[model samples]
Target: MPEYTTGKPWRLSAFPPLLWAVALLLTLSLAYAAQSGATYILIDDNLDTELAPPYALLQEGKALDYRSTTRVDRLMNGLPRNALRPGLQPLVGLMALFPPLEAYLLHELLVRLAGLLGMYLLLRRYGLPGPRLAALCAGLALAWAVLPAYTAYGVSVLGQPWVALALLNLRRGPGRWSDWLVLVVFAFWSSLVLAGMFVLAAAGLLLLRDTWRHRRIAWRPVLGLLVLGISYGVVEYPLVYSLLVKRQFVPHRLEFDYARLAPGGVGVGLASAGRYLLLGQYHAGLFLRAAPLLAAGLALAYAPAGAARRRLLRKLLAGVGVLVGVALFCGFYPQLIGVVQQTVPPLRAFNLSRFHFLTPLLWFGVLAFSLRHLPGPGLRAALVGLQLLLGLGMNTEWTLNVRRLLGRLPATEPTYAAYVAPELFRRIRQDVEARTGQQPARYRVACLGFAPAVASLNGFYTLDAYQNNYPLAYKHQFRELIAGELARSPELRTYFDAWGNRCYLFSAELGKNFRVAALPERAVAHWAFDARSFRRLGGRYVLSAARLLHPEASNLRLLGEYAAPGAYWHIWLYEVR
Candidate 1:
């Protein structure tokens, strides 16, 4: 044996068989419990477009707006919208482009298996005692449940942890070409943009390196440095290519709105909003609260001196560099900030603060690594316990004050809430099928809350809801309906007419609430018929095309109500012939 200088002969090697057995038992138990919770969520919430990019990609393929490159169509076109722009980034979409069955298997592998493997690699790289590493990782997964985004999506989304661990390894390496290759792949795979910023910082620091003395410089870190060049290349090359060569998608609309730099404005350029996502609040706030400890860690790692100091210091520097880089880029990058402000909500609709997701992880990781090399177990434990207590206490006080001021809800209930109306949709689909002898399978519907849900599960298109294609919808390309410019275009009017003619019509008041002012008043009135002509179907209500004299529907009928008792509101269905 090399030495038993460490504790308990590295528990993993000591009791491999026993450890595997225990792991199996715990995993099975956890899987069973998760399956139970999985029952309450809808198909969209299950493994679909609201999250997992792979599923989103698959949905994009099913929709076939493949050539529709603009942002509006990108969300609305739905298939793996990211698949439309094939390459290394949007790695989730790239994975999705594989054969469906294989894509699913690979996606499962990446999101779930890779995450576990990533954690294992991290522990191994850090030279943690196997048992201690296992304990730490298990505690993290269970208590903190660090993979909340993955859990929410019902997909692993392992890219974040995978990148974190890989970058951590790259920090202390002059390894084989394969190591560098893996780092490159990891860099390309970060869709969260946090990873991209980290890769950039890592590369930048490498550029500033003059020499690696006691330890010879390796090619892996150098290879990994390529990621920084790649990022600049990605943005600059496209614009240059458009301008010089083909002029593909240009006027080169590189927007620069510095007002976003103002405290509250949502403009894109040089704004706090973008930076806030990566840097998060702590760093973004006055004094760069995390900076000193970050500086201390860097000082220990880089300040010339002792060999013992250097080894540990190097690791700290590399890790801290990655953390700081991620923070700075996320704080600085305007487009990314705007993206979060646009796509995710409560973050968007309410606070317009998109950075909260990555912020917690950044601080937590920094805190963990900063304390990693404390002298002894007892001392380390005390130091960690103190930090945790202090940090948690501070956060609690901050949260309480913020809650008192802003009246925020506790984490359990989502703020800016939308209802779960799965039963309502199922009823609509069923009744439409029964009355018209045609299922709602072939055509799309236009209800607010249930359109994406319907399109995802029922495999139909929805006019009112856009998937990942926010550019078109948000930019108002579908302006004819939203701005009451319905009279302006024959094509837009035709689309409205066809939508109205569908056998399925979800109720209007419900439609109005869901649309959030996108739908033209005329579109709702023309398609939904009138409040006066429809009859109530007991718990459900419907309007018939027969009641309203229109060129489209002359003979329509009321459908039986499809709603959970006590949950009835606006989402009723009507069958028009």
Candidate 2:
């Protein structure tokens, strides 16, 4: 909605030096980490969750398989390959071309680089023409590139600039081939459920407004947007097939009780709104909300002194208003939409509250427009410099890398090398084979004190995993094994039942800690597990990250306690005999 102007290309000077330097350093650090595989990569909801599926598909020789029924047996007892993310995606496709970590790193770098260039193009092509303004826009673009976004999510957040540029190009009569190309590739590179649907909705509104203003349908932009939508549908064929054609599998999302889970009272809703407006939603990666907020405040105060006039003030303020309105809407949506979901039932499966996914780009776009209006180069540079520092400070991955380099990484955290200890897992896999006298693929293992991703990533067939979507029935079945433990912990029970996306092995003793290494290595002394159900559900081994006091209490046989130097987890492999 920020692209409401027209302009000719203007030269940005060599550019905002600090941001580019920081961006380069972050890129080099990540590249080095990826290449060396000896430092921390983001773990929470990342390496242990999203990255597992594609890497598992790659590991299982199904990275390129696009069939609807193609199953990857490594996860949740052959979770329908469709249940895992589509391989037709650019990120997963990269896995086929390179090793997992390197591929992930390359994909991340490409997303940022594309964002940098795309934002530059959008700014230069719209308003913001002079050298200093253009340079500031470039700095804003670079700031966008390094905003701690989820790497595996591809271009969902960062690709918004490309989408905006492409649509704006189409609005100017019969656009270039480059515009169409951007949409097509963007369809493949970005997630439909994440930001695509919201983008389409917003674009539709914009198109409607344009038609009303000009007294004719903006058919070209509409047609271009259609191409974008259709491309996404094609790329997300598996999702379409699973939801529409495939009748047997039901997602656990349908069972979600928003009231019980999120508890969206007015107070909570306002808090959530404030967080999104000021700090930003955590998943898409909050960066420099302060930058945009501060820039808008300054621009408003200095509006009369605008060397460029009040049009800049109106444009940026419009953008800020959009952010505030959207944030409040998103914040209250869970509470407000519960009635609709309850009435429709099936509609509950679709997460309609993700409109905040559009905010990061919106925030940066606002920053760019605000920078353009600021009367002087010094003021603009100061704002840009403030943004550079804030973005750098908030980017946990970049700071984590620096800490890893300096040997001061927190004791609680594990490096990418230590987290996924190949040598240690290889030994554990061999030990399991030696003890069980069978390939890991033949028997499913459940992780106790750690993420199942650790085992699954190491090529073990896992009974449990951290996934976005899996069979509802499998979730119920998996719960039986953890039901005893769940009974003891109401919090864990509510967590698994009310919003059971995880469907992981929950423990009352460990209390929802997938990685228990950070805490004192306390034994799960009172684990009420159903080993009979576990083996019945095809579980043969339990790879405990910490020791279990009495294996006999749960009919488990401790095979061995394994440790590798520099590894985060000390696995206690147990057989469910």
| Candidate closest to the true structure, highest lDDT | 2
All candidates: TM-score: 0.52, 0.93
Candidate 2 residue lDDT tens string, 275-378 = 88887776787765877778878877777765554676677768888889998988887787677777888876777878888888778777777776577788
- lDDT string, candidate 1, 143-171, tens digits: 12222233322221333444455455665
- What are the lDDT figures for the candidates, one per model? 0.38, 0.79
How many residue-pair clashes does candidate 1 contain? 17
Candidate 1 local distance difference test against the native: 0.38
RMSD of each: 11.5, 5.2
The list of candidate 1 runs beyond 4 A from truth reads 1-13, 16-113, 123-181, 184-194, 197-201, 204-219, 224-369, 382-423, 437-442, 466-475, 484-561, 565-570, 574-577
Where model 2 places Cα greater than 4 Å from the true spot, the runs are 1-36, 246-248, 305-317
Winning model by TM-score: 2
lDDT score of residue 165 within candidate 1: 55
